[model samples]
Target: MMRSGLLLFFIGLAACSPPVTKSKAKIEEFRQYLEKSRTDDGVLLESRMLAGSNGLVWENSGKYQGDILLDDSQLEDLVADFAGVSNDNNRNAFVVANTRWPNNVMIFNYASNEFNNAQQNAIRTAMSWIEHFSCVRFRWRSNERVFVRMTGNPTGCYAHVGFSTAHPNRVLNLARNNHCFSHGVIIHELLHSLGFQHMHQTYERDSFVRINWNNIISGQEFAFTRFPRNQVNLHGLPYEYTSIMHYHNQAFSRNRQPTIVPLRSFSGTMGQMEQTSYWDWLRLRRHYNCPGAWNRNSEEIMKKEVERTLPLIKLNLPAPKQGLFTDEDNAYVRALNADTNNEDIVNEEAMDYEDSDNENNNFNEDIGNDNYEN
Candidate 1:
């Protein structure tokens, strides 16, 4: 009788298993849909330069603040803020409420040929670093409806600010052979995709550092634009000069002179991309509402918290009501251009990110053209 009961249990488990053929078909269907969604119909709303380790890198015509690809409504909100017409002072962490990745998880996919093995490893290393410090987790794409598609376009490194609602399938381009594969650069671009903006762009930045506009390159001034205080939630933490997201002293300089001068003397390096500073990691944890993120050994504590909440995941516990220093529940940020009718410009390719070994031989030929320009 016991043998018969065990047999029945095993049979029940097999019956409950999902059909393999149907799953493969569904995945293939999504791949076809993604291919059809690729287009070049987007407008060149804004562009900004970034000071990577290889010196000043120009922005692609369609990017904002160096590499952020903004969608329609986000662009509208930013335009209004830029025009000094916006009265909506929602102080969430300079991020759109809905832009946060659901469940603090990030789903990603990349073409096999877009990046070489070293670059791919760098991407994983950066993701691992974030995972080690915060509650944010990364997973290679399966059948996720919304995910970041990393490309190896030679257009300099850039990413959409977050999970774009207007373009659910977003692309983050890390230009091949463009010095974009460094661990720090990978972390910087990944942070952008994770919805974090440049630290110097925060509204209260003027009090800490002075922007030397005269030293800035012409037509690149947009890169140094600031976010208004009302539009940003700083989490009451003091300005972080050592933030990985902070630009180097000579960022966007036309004459190799300093553009960002500190008002007060400080220890440590400014705009160091070596690793995410403590404050930088803290903001990310808070943004994701990671439990016990404020205390030491928080990462281990968070891991246990995740385990404890597994059975109760459906309950969706509430986040902290307000920040320790601020009066808001989350920080809110806004930006981009005002064009609403334009489509996105990323041309995403679909394939198994890990197993596929196709080589993009045409990548060199494709780089010579100025297709990335407006």
Candidate 2:
């Protein structure tokens, strides 16, 4: 009887399963999910409907990938900052940052024992960069169960690199023994954490070489950009790359070399006090808007600020249309749709498996299965 039931199940599956087809909406959604998933491993699953995209699988891999580490006090501090914005428009814009940070911010180096003074200083410097420019706050937590281990290089050193559960937030310069190490990398990664895609080399206007945006893998583009037309206002003012939230690398040239001068040349090392950019100040002010003089519990006020500001943040890319099937270009749309849907269902089940208890022990085994639907 058990054998007969199993044979019947197989027959049913064979009859129901269809072939793959082109789905433009699914493809575009897959692309967006791929872009957002790179920010952090945890939220990758939440970002898209793709069954087998690498970003989705990577997200389900149980690794913590965010930069902002928040403890109870820090969370309160951030909440208080949003409470201070007076203008309803500005306050609405501010709340977007608040909603994005807590769950989006993954914890790293939660225990003091995990880092030394220099490492702590590195973390502080990275945090300072985000705070001063990005208007985001960092905090520490006591929980280890939620923490994900960094793979690749392990010398038991925890200060290698840090990012958001979504993107690179703050990377520790464990590679640099001297204090003169570049904070630009941390800044660069932080921009990625914030959902900016790399600029195309052909479109760049500065002395810096533009990134080959086309070269970016389909899903990874969001790591370096705001949507093409999306204009994000850092504070009450307009946003600009000079605001310190921009990526700094070898500038545009026939031959690639560092085009922009190091920030340290104008200022000092991480310890040296530096003047904040206008945009930076505005970002902080917007982020921490409160009703009173201090505006400590301004979460509601900040929410209003974000709601207003979101419209201003425009994406350069065209709005994606739903139900646009890619694989069906000249082929039968019905057949293609059936195939894609079948693949999507299988991929979803696989993702569920990857997210379960067997993840760590079965990572290698699962990676092969993950590449199937992509």
Q: Give the C-alpha miss distance for residue 220 in model 1, angstroms.
A: 2.6
Candidate 1 Cα lDDT to native: 0.53
List clashing residue pairs in candidate 1. Answer: 92-330, 92-331, 92-332, 93-330, 93-331, 93-332, 94-332, 94-333, 95-332, 95-333
Q: What's model 1's TM-score? A: 0.61
List model 2 lDDT by residue over 38-103, tens digit each.
233333322321333221111122222222223233233222322331233542342233223343
Off by over 4 Å in 1: 1-62, 80-96, 295-374
What Cα-based lDDT does every candidate model obtain? Answer: 0.53, 0.28
Cα displacement (angstroms), candidate 2, residue 109, comes to 4.1
The TM-score measured for candidate 2 stands at 0.32
Q: TM-score per candidate, in order? A: 0.61, 0.32
For model 2, where is the 10-residue window of minimal lDDT? Answer: 4-13
